[model samples]
Target: MEEIDKTFREAVADGRIHGAVLIAKDLTGKVDFSRSYGVRSLREEDPEKRPPMVADTPMRVASCSKFLTSIMVLKCVEMGLANLNGGLEKLLPEVAGLKVLTGFDDAGNPIEREPKSPVLLNSGLCYTLTFPLLQQYRKWQGLEIEQGYDNLDQNFKYPLLFDPGTKWAYGPSLDWCSRVIKRASGLSAEEFLQEHIVEPLGIDSDNMTFELQKHPNMQARRGDMTFRGGHTFTAESSSPGTGVLQYRDEEYWHEDIEPHGGQGIYTSPESYAKVLWSILSNDGKLLKPETRELLFKRALTLEAEKSFDEYCEQFKAFVPGVPVPAEIKHSHSLGGMLTLEDCDGDRWRQEGNLSWSGLPNIMWNIDKRAGMCTIWAFHMKPWGDPICIELGTKFEKAAFMMLKQ
Candidate 1:
């Protein structure tokens, strides 16, 4: 652990890692150890400069929020507020008649549009909002929109990419799911999540909600040519990558939608570790143990091999089927990108490990096989460059070694 910590610190000192929170848990999913590294800002420093890199500073841990959002939705499922196949129609009356987008033409135009038939509740959980989903979603935002949510209204030609069950193109699915939960539970997504998951787990805003309000400023970072070659920072929120970005600053939190529920979450090593424990433990607080099992299990598709290639070129996710239960097959689980296979063959191959990475390079991996969850976060530019790969792999090996001990 010392060697791992030293290298991680050295990387931060050398401008290799931006900011991170790292944790390694035992087989029971208890985070026996957790550590955070680096400052939220990535600026270079001089001898007289005061630099801060620590666990106290809050951060907007992008896509990692998906698990929390998903869990909150599932809790609704457990409480009988939502059925796996029923939420869409109940949440959005207009969505029942939506035309799923198929593709865009040569000029970047949506090409195919057809009525989405027999949609699954999980599909809406992924970001399939119709006028009803959007209109009812206002409860989550607390503002009545003159119009409903649409990535691009009247862009039916933008197409559905592929039939819902036939492919996995990650987009605004989770946002739509948030709306579904809001409509079904008759509570704003934030309030519902707080009452059911956040408060129960003791998770708080920690200024992340505040930062998002400032949008384009709060949670903003500037790129550079180097430590000395200054770069003009951009003022914008809403990450295009993985659709997991948010535009919020201190002022944004004041708004009803500050938490945004999509990503703007300020998490810590201990807090996030608790979430990993809940999901893996299935302790009956968040979701039933069996429900948690289904989450980690593959939810890809029947023809994932053939269709996924068409949807994405990188990572190339595959459903290898379930290794946990005879009746369960993990082949369809889309919990997290299988960005990692093995840390060096000396460690686990990352199978059955549900996890995600924050833009600042905070990465987590869960090994259901060992009931262990490891998270490492760092603030650095080019978030997922080779530096993260090497360090992330080393971190995984170290965590596994800790469990072995």
Candidate 2:
């Protein structure tokens, strides 16, 4: 493990990973080991070195916040607070007015759709925020958004490409789920998380919110991501395809916005590792196996007829992330993307394996075969290096490797 850790640090030492933390847990919830690498912040605010990336230091964990929202939503479902099959028109009458923008008709004219199905409570459980619908909704009602959250929007008030179940778009759908969580449980996203997920699980509080006080080294920074073919993805707030290169827009930091369930939370390697430990074991203290099993199962699978329309078209409107292959078993669990096969970079689908990552770069993997899991994290990317991904793959493989040994 020491050798693995040393190699991981070396792989990212070129300042690509700024800092990182890793946690390995066996099936029984026993943490085999924990460690932190690099300084607390690249800015290194302290004259002294970073405190070990332990359970305490809050890390900006991007979209990892979705998993917590997933849990809260699931809890509401388990308690029979919300029905999984009802459409959005029923659950959220406000969205009854959304329209669909299918590219164009045969004559290169715009095609407007009346939506085959309304968004559903379960659909919101999956993050499928889209752009055309966002804009259209705002126009329909003269809407204006305050935060990247809750029932109101200058951004999300538009129509959707397809009604809820038909399309699959990746986004702040957690924002929608946040609304469902509030409606179903009579609790806000933050409150539901604190009461049900965080407090009960004994999770550290700092890593759960967005907009922490700026720390020199650890603060997230925006960066330019030059993809495969000279395509550069850039944004300070939210990229359509790629995630937070850095997340410090004044509006983002200052507003008393609703929880940015997609990318607002913070975490340290140690604290998130504990979450992995809890989920992997079901803790007997948190969720029963039945509830956890539901969490692992696919809440949503990409529909064969409209895969591209859902992922590449509507969802990737701006950032432009590639569509995961059909062979790649990607499911929408409350915890975000679930893997059914081993996704070693280009291919991330692992058969019967359920897992996902937080924004920038934080991953949680559960191998059903191994009946074990691991957790890992780093601040943000676009550091002119791919060390975080590189190191994560290495350490994750190493952790799994040791189990066989």
- Residues 1-405 of candidate 1 have per-residue lDDT tens digits of 899879978976775555556777765543377676655443444423424545544454555676677777777777887776552666654555456544445665434456454556454222222223433333334544432323223211122434567655444455455666777788866667667776777666442231344434433321111111111111121221122122122322244342334454555555667778767666777777877776776666567534444433332221111111122222435355442244334355345566665544556667776677766655332344345557877777777766555
Error of 2 at 271 (Å): 2.6
Worst 10 residues of 2 by lDDT: 222-231
What local lDDT does model 1 show for residue 294? 65
- Residue 144 in candidate 1 has what lDDT? 42
Q: Which stretches of candidate 2 lie over 4 Å from their true place?
A: 11-13, 28-31, 44-52, 103-111, 124-152, 210-255, 301-327, 342-350, 383-385
For model 1, how many clashes? 43
Runs of candidate 1 with Cα error greater than 4 angstroms are 28-31, 42-51, 93-96, 102-111, 124-158, 207-261, 309-334, 337-346
Alpha-carbon TM-score of each model against the true structure: 0.71, 0.74
| Per-residue lDDT of 222 in model 1 | 19
Distance from true position, residue 118, model 1, in Å?
3.4
